[model samples]
Target: MKVSTIEPAQPLDHLAPAGRIGVVALATDFNIEQDLRRMLPGDTQIFTSRVRNYNPLTIENLRSMAPGISAAADTILPGTQLDAIIYGCTSGTVAIGSERIAELIHQSCPGVPVTNPVTAAVAAFRQLGARRISILTPYTEQVNCEVAELFQRHGFEVLNIAGFGFEDDTAMTFISPVDIVNAAKNVCDAQADLLFVSCTALRASVVLDEIEAQLGKPVVSSNQALTWHSLQLLGYPAPVSGYGSLLQQLPV
Candidate 1:
């Protein structure tokens, strides 16, 4: 009997085709992954990273937690084969400093582009021609102050900032989308060209479209901006609709 020989598959061929992005999220979060999948295009995949929680979401805790988060990214990335990675926390990135967080992730995964939500938010603001931004957050006063300083250092004007003063990060995730939209309407200034609903935990994405329509300006949330930026970094110009003006109309 003659037997046909089967050819062995190449190592790279066995792996699934790499998408444009990889997102590393906090461990104790809400359904950020599910939300991302629902919001992003089918071609993009988000990878979550495990990191320890240092409560209060303060700057000191963020600084203390950077190594663990970076290490988590390093551990999860090699197997996934992603084009770019996003550190998926707005407050975490702001507290740690966007440049510092990006550098750390880059050091861990060389040649892999790293972006943070804070940096992405700033970039989105610039891209959308926003000069004055109204900020909303679910952080304590201290953390909010740090974010304001970080944005100021990056050269964007902060017209107003409001925080819900919630100390727990997980609890922030339960905030209603309608509440976020109402807060934006109340805090946003007519002079401000953009509204920034800051916090990965907050459910800002659900109400982004409504807020933008009501205010007649671009509305950006932590996860939305990061996802868009991550996709852009991966060289995928995914046209996202029904989210906000930033996603629907802004150029990648």
Candidate 2:
């Protein structure tokens, strides 16, 4: 073998990836993983970290998941750089606060962009030109009220909010799509320009297209918007169809 000491005329072409995004998913979450897989481009890679979560999905229980987030994120391809990290629970993000979650995740992975369902939902609503949004949730009234207030605080008009009246976090995942669609119809209003399905555990994307077609407006869901916004933060906001209108219309 002959070895050349001189430098090559052209440096080797660098290999770049589409992007790498992270999700700090709850241990009990059953849908976020699949939903993200369906929406993200084939070139993009996802890394997950499942944090501990308790039943009832109370403010207290939701907040308790925060401590495990940093450690969970640390496990996703250790020593590898990430483009963005998403705290994947919608209500949990509200209970814990997006800024605070971002602050906590950044404690271990500094300077990386962080987002949650709440922040991403708001951004999705904006991108879809929806100011008056009808909110549908699988939570009880209390959590719905808190989330309504949270959305209003961020300047979205909550035309109506209807919950399935469930408090069990794991059970929310079991609620049939038929029941969710019914609850959405109950909350759907003429004054509302958009419909929002909250909760990462609830299977909203299964009926996302049907709901949007029936209501003649856009429908944004927890996992759907989370993946879209996470991709947006990584500068890959191209149109993705069949999941929802948010991803199909939003541009980078």
Candidate 1 ranges beyond 4 A from true positions: 1-20, 77-80, 249-251
Question: For every model in order, what is the number of clashing pairs?
Answer: 0, 0
Mind giving the per-residue lDDT tens digits that candidate 1 earns over 28-68? 67856766777777766676776776777777877787878
**Residues 1-252, candidate 2, lDDT per residue (tens digit)?**
997798789978533277888889989888888878877888787889899988887788888888888888888777889889888899899899988898889888998999899999999988888889889998888888899999999998898898888888778889999987777777889899899999998888888888887888888999899878877887874777887788886566
TM-score of predicted structure 1: 0.89
- Measured against the true structure, the TM-scores of the candidates, in listed sequence, are 0.89, 0.91
Q: Residue 210's C-alpha lDDT in candidate 2?
A: 86
Residue 90's C-alpha lDDT in candidate 1? Answer: 82
C-alpha-based local distance difference test score of model 2: 0.86
Reference-based lDDT, residue 75, model 2? 83
- After aligning candidate 2 to the native by TM-score, how far in Å is the CA of 202 from where it should be? 1.3
